[model samples]
Target: MIDSGESAVSDSILFVTHSPQRSGAESVMLDLAAECHRRGMSVSVACPVGPLSESFPPWAVHVEIPHLGRDHGRRTRAGAAWGMARSMVVAARTLRAHRGTAIVANSAHTLPALRLAGVRSVAWLVHDHLVSRKTRVFIGAGRPLLHHVVAVSPTTASALDGLVDHVAVGRLGVDIPDDAPTGALPTGPLRAGTLSVLTPWKGVDVFLEAVARLDDATAVVAGEAFPGDVGYAAQLRERAGHPDLAGRVTFPGRVRAADALAQWTVHVSASIAPEAGPLTAMEAMAAGVPVVATDHGNPRNLLADRRGVLVPPGDPVALADAMSSIAADPHGTAAMVRRAYAHVAEHHDRRETVPALLDLLLGTTSSSAPAAPADAVAAPSRGGGGSR
Candidate 1:
């Protein structure tokens, strides 16, 4: 826990997020907001009313705004722009009302609105790799408005190299209980699973393909699709029913991370696109599940030095091979799991990250602050339900 004795920096801190969904970035925001509140800072969150709102700390203020950003499949480009414009107006009003509160934009979509509001103490927590040219241009244009830019990983920080100066790496962290379930590999037929929202780029399709190659493994794809990606989710369900996957695959809708990890012998992160820093992978490591992640973004760094297995992105054969190797070599898998657990404890523990982020936000730092690493590529820009 961060000390509550420091002198107040801002009267309050307003956390602005574009989407209402409780995905990776939003999850981080919730944790950060809770910590801020714990430290006796006035905390408020502004976002479209949805599941995320329900998850906010009860004491924190909730300011509703129009859904911002492009919902690629569900809305026309012009419609998204109009929605964003309306959101900006609402956000600007909120900024005026909360005059001295430092602003924390949880997604790039909120940047324009913060810029419109003209708040100088803005911190943009970059969660995804911005691959779209238009998003890069828009964020770059608003760069002057951001007082500090912190990324969830070194790879994510690299993406903002020339676009934003003084970009710092603040890696995502997970809660690791002292008695966290850690031990030898489970004794049973291989059970593989992944915890991610159902979306095209997340590659649930690729995961199903890999599951098809595992003759005896039962697999679970545990997450719900947003409104815009229902068609893609349906396609994944249809793919699961094919003869190859047949009764072996299950669509368990969204389960709690701990519940999902507890049921799986092997956890997979099969995103076709590069992920900035996936919380699910980190959680699995902390929970003692062997991880097989795509070789891109933060997974590459997390799984380096044989802490876990890294398969080529979008390659079902490689994914399948990696899964099989884990099941076949329990001895090796257990060693890797132990190494992974230690690595997460030393680096990605929430006990460390949450305070680091609070210090960064409050403009205070202790000897424990993590040093910024060498920057590397722009990440995929996030929006309402696309390109995350």
Candidate 2:
């Protein structure tokens, strides 16, 4: 562990982000950077810089490279690979210049270069499942190069069997003001469903299908298209006006970063594919709002038997029923709010998570695995039985 008392910091950590864009991964990195800074570590972030330049910390130095963007297809994939190699070379040179600190490689694209840079201690933070074959290959190449692989969830950790030497599960922390509104009961007919990026995996279409089934409450969707997702977003907007869904749906485009987590009554993370760990659900729980979500990815682990309702993915009937249950019972909503706040307070609180994560990064802990105590239950996927 690097010293952290009332001493001057000799170590620095370089955070490499592939997409400087304000998605969940970037948000997690920002929290980690802020936490590191608070703990007296010299910190900086490097990215293939663009519009996201404004999103960095004022005090920390920013490094820019030409290789990163929001592209995901085959041709762009080859470009990203080449760009990563060049960026890695530059990163290695920079690390040598800085000397004493560790490197926190936050993206799949930056791992190989960090390895080549020969930093004795390098930690790779993995935020999602290596779903595609290409992702698996990228991760596989970086396996031996990383000192530790930090997975955001247990399921994600389980997926990386031979990729990394050590694996740790670090859940994201949710920090909301103590004086923020609490004990909130659903008082209006307006219900909100949010996922900041409109994509197939996020189940935006599935959410709209559920909205078509709801008659009592208005469903507001918050998100916009990324570079290649404009067509999908347009189709969703068009379908929002089906005969059954016409009056109930509202597409609010994109929710601003500052207000994304705070403006909704109920947050819905309607993911069809298993996501790594969804911050929106955690944010909703922190805001004392109940959530209705599909049992895909980390929500099953996060919500368990408290604070939210889980339904089978792509099942509009089940989703509609779950939404109705939340909308019809105001008392239930209040209880869920209490449970949500309590759940996040006990597990996802910054005070608890940040320290644990620091310990892992510093090599003070033997197991990076998340502890599932008796009070905490694991969330399951679509067909898995609910935990009581």
Candidate 3:
């Protein structure tokens, strides 16, 4: 990462997000982008074309183009490449429009084009671990392009194998109010909350299986179905209605991130697959809600002090037991909330993370320096090509 701490102010920033909707990655992008905009730096977010493109704030600029890669099988390989090319053209044009602007590219997927465009002063923000071949390809491709890399946690940074320029383990923050009212809890039984998109990888089925293990717990499932995965959501709904666990589970569709947090006593993150870092968990913690999450990937690092229970992945019995334990102990639940807040205040506060992230954008703070004495390229790394 190039050390640009020498500079005073960043003129503008182009944040590359893969989605316009509210995913974990997009949540970080929006929060930071809004903050930068608040700080009087011109900030804009560019995302692949989608229905949610209209949701960006009116003051900030928005650009949409074909996805760098297709989601699932929406486009062929050549089509994805072409889409990427189109997105690159838009990105380059956007960068040129706001000359001297910093490009904060989110996700490893955009690395290749950021590289091809030769846009100097780029920060690669790693929102999660890349465990798949396609994801690794993107990471390996973009490792060189980064002036710095921002990871959401130390655990996340450690998992990256030192490929990033500067490894800042900045956690995402939530602006939960201290005086906000905790809404009335359901009178029926022990209510559990889940806030994630309905995708197979997110393990909603696994969550349902856990619900099956609970006789009195009612699980409130939030978030929309992923592209081409509505059927899976239906299956979860149907499964929850089975005689075994029918009255114990319900799907209420998507909830506004803030409003959703206000409605739940506990947050559940049941991802069976590797999650880079989930904003859902962070938000839940910030809202002072105890989370019952899987003990893999980033959650283990975030939820340390028994603030929340950590269960092995793909284990419903464990999840059920943990939920029951939490529901049974109100005092323990309050303690969990306090501990979670303290953890966020001590380590994951956005106040600390955002400025460090800005350092990456300004080229002031980075782990790796620029590659050559050139304007565009940064130093090469072990398993990658030019600077992303």
Candidate 4:
């Protein structure tokens, strides 16, 4: 949507991502974009054509871009380099065509595009504390088109401590219910579950192993690998097929967001790697499900209160103990659920946090209070270094 004769009131925000997959990071981006649309700010998303793109609403503009392969083999790396360069130029050209549209680089893959755009885009970092050397260099260089870098987790913010000029923790927003039924637990056997992308680092194996140790609870896992990650998913299937896990572990491939969490008695997040911003965990807490997450990454920060329990990362025995403890104490679990609902409402509610995010982007200029223009109060103004 363009500014018709300079009378447009809405600000335009263009979101860029590497893949359209519904991963944790992408979910956060989509949530913010959807919230922006709700707030009457014109929103659009640019990503590779896939299932994840379908999640975007009909009202927002959709831009399909090339998929740059990863840095694995030499051939793939070369191809990715070429594709990344081309994609960056294409993204810059697309933005150049549409004036006054702020850019939000949803992934590190969009770094090249932000560099080319010249200090007009914000780097939305959701990937963990491990910032790649190349990405760090790209961010370290004071590119004119690049805006300040904002991360979804404090761990991520701390990891990138000195590399960037500006860093802020853009907390992921969750929708908390006005009221929740306390002491009303799900019927039948307790279910221990986790929502994650089907990668080894996500610790699905650990979750399955933990489930195998317990008898009273069924294990429900939700996730699927990317298009070409068949081997990885197949290995996970092999793990689920173990004799101890027979009829106990169920991998419902890529169910709707929060579907697994809502049904389960106690939600689990067993990521071995340092998590950035976990949308499923946030959604589960918002839904009043008691969470048992790894004591690492964003979960460690979110589960500061007695809302949920935490275990050592990658330890199946510890996870099993946590799950067992929660299952045994029904009253305690119910109380924890209430605390979780309150915690999410106080920190992550959308009615408050969504506008705060918009302010973060709009206030990225040299001036502390970069006010939206009179006509574009519905959206952000076309100020310098306005985030994408």
Candidate 5:
């Protein structure tokens, strides 16, 4: 429990994010903010003016910090740094205004600003793999300023091994819809789809190629592109018009995950780069939608134990085969769906993860709280059925 003397400040939490886009990390913070508001905590989000700002709960405060990292137009390295510096100025001022409120830096991009603010109660919630040397160096430089560091998955925690210490694994969770079709497979022709920002690294093209191999199955690539990736998005749109995939693939722009998943017979995560913990795949698992993800990063662990299927990254043939197998083996697929639902319910329920995160933000802990164990941060069990 929080100390009585610090209750006043501890009850207020300010979340600082780098992107205005409602991606996985932003969605997590939004959900957390809503939960905090429901619990009568003072919640404020400091981010740039964009789609994310419009989604905050009515009671929560929205502090608009212009040009905060992600949305800044293309610029030189020095220019980007200068923009971040300006954003940090505003961020520091916001921190000073809030005074003792606990702070959650929702992205590594916010770390430098948090360091500049020099607040004591700060938690850096890391969501990326930090594979780039530049990103690793950037995050490592401000690590000492963080009071607590939380990673969304063990793979993510492992990536930060030497860069930061005492890293806690905080797996992303989703609300299992009351109508989630557990143990029930979708009927009719196969409809494989993926829900993520249409970036090259996400391997949306690979998913399209896999869907092309299917004779009559349709596909939905449901997301918009980031500003910097507009060219890639255009390329994807053009590819969708190619001979093989012409009318089979549909780009529905941006969509709610549930809306998209409801239409998908199978959900795919075909990222060329290793994902930390993709919320879309987790949501699919929780909703009893069979997942076929690349056998690397968090997905390898996520889909392990026959809970879902795993395919090699960028392998269209393997991905296509996995989708076809789901339709061919309905009984097996349903069983996998059931196991996935059970796994998500037991391990990734937001009821458990949110409070655990809240405890970190509130500077409180209890025996039952989901704190990291001594040897390593806790992750979902990886042993069970063999990989398909």
Candidate 6:
């Protein structure tokens, strides 16, 4: 398929990611890789050995390196840099062996490393809204080699204004299985819950504080702390053990969004900080569960017709009232949930969004290409804290 003169790039793609976790970003990367290979392009992924590495199929090549994680806040700057430097050295050697037409960096962690290795035509997929001064300098230095950037949300895209030369929006997609298990409406005490990684910024604490106020509603919190934030989850458990929260609040710990949504009467997204589009929230909407999300960041981008309830971020009083309201007006909420479910099906389906993501990666979309729908800008919430 290639001419002799054009030897460097030949429809091969190399995907680089930092850690092999079940996070939303990793899910998108694996889904994208599978889609690319299905389209007849050669694809391979290079990541550290961890739980998620096993999820890659036999059709895709997997290259393992030292295990990777986020920079610990308590670690000294020099120490963090040194550890990353060692990982970079090994990753570079692996990259050199797997030549491709374009190299894709799944997160900011891999972009600089690939840049330092002199990899050509590198594409950076912005999963989170990263705009640190240090990150800016590193990306700026590597700007010459960059092909473009694919941000998951408009907020993320807007954040990249001065940081990168070319920017594209990639919305997150959800695959609704025909055989997806259906959940029944609750008949007893109002059971409300949320599925999210337990972190301070994720605002599970806010969810808990609000749940403490609703005497008629029982709450379930699913999701464990990620690698870097175990202490925060421990604190949540300690708080859940408080006498006031006693028998009302439960921590189920790291269940799939589908299972959690099916178990609860209402699904909630109570993040305090801005989040990219969260797949859990999208999946919940797809499953016909009523949603209550904070009115900041990517959630604003998803619920266009006010399908889900929105509350002020960090306000436990407002969040509690929203959850209680959903539990009270089942018939009214069911009518609203139908509209929300239809909105998700029409827009956020993976079948439609994956090709759009590949188009951005392959430089296939042109100026005359159809304008982006609002969903692409708030497509998938690939934020580090929301899923996984």
Q: Candidate 2: minimum summed lDDT over ten consecutive residues — where?
A: 379-388
lDDT of 4: 0.68
Candidate closer to the true structure by lDDT (higher is better), 3 or 4: 4
lDDT of each: 0.79, 0.67, 0.67, 0.68, 0.77, 0.74
Report the candidate with higher lDDT, 1 versus 4.
1
- Put down candidate 4 lDDT per residue, 271-324, tens digits, no spaces: 888787576777888887888999987777778767789999989999999988
> What is candidate 6's local distance difference test score?
0.74
Best by lDDT: 1
Instruction: Report the C-alpha lDDT of model 2 over 1-388, residue by residue, as the tens digit.
Output: 1332222224567777666566888777777777678768777787766545577768677876444333555377678666556666776665555335656667776655555665555677778765456566555655554555677777676566554555766676767547544556546664767755887778888878877776766677777777668888888988987787777778777675336555556677788888776777777787777788888677777777666899998887888788777767778777777877777776777666666665555555425335533233324222212111
Give one digit per residue, the lDDT tens place, for model 3 in 59-166: 778765446555455457776666666765665554455435677888676666666566555677767754456667676766655666766655556556545445
- Ranking of all predicted structures according to lDDT, beginning with the best and ending with the worst: 1, 5, 6, 4, 3, 2
Query: What are the models' TM-scores?
Result: 0.90, 0.82, 0.82, 0.83, 0.89, 0.87
Q: Which 10 consecutive residues of model 1 have the lowest summed lDDT?
A: 379-388
What lDDT is reached at residue 197 by model 6?
77
The candidate with the higher lDDT, 1 or 2, is 1
RMSD of each: 5.0, 6.2, 6.3, 6.7, 5.6, 5.3
Expressed as tens digits, the lDDT of each residue in 1-388 for candidate 6 is 1222232334678788888676788888888898788778887888877767788888878878654445675378888877877777777676666544467778776766666566766777887764776666556655665665788878777676655655778787797656432334667877888888787888999988998898777889887777788889888889888987888888888777777777678888998877788888889888878888999878887765767889999999999899888877777787777777777676777887777776776666534234456666533322322101
After superposition, which runs of candidate 2 have C-alpha atoms over 4 Å from their true positions? 1-10, 68-100, 116-120, 177-184, 256-265, 364-388
Ranking by TM-score, best first?
A: 1, 5, 6, 4, 3, 2
Candidate 3 lDDT score relative to the true structure:
0.67
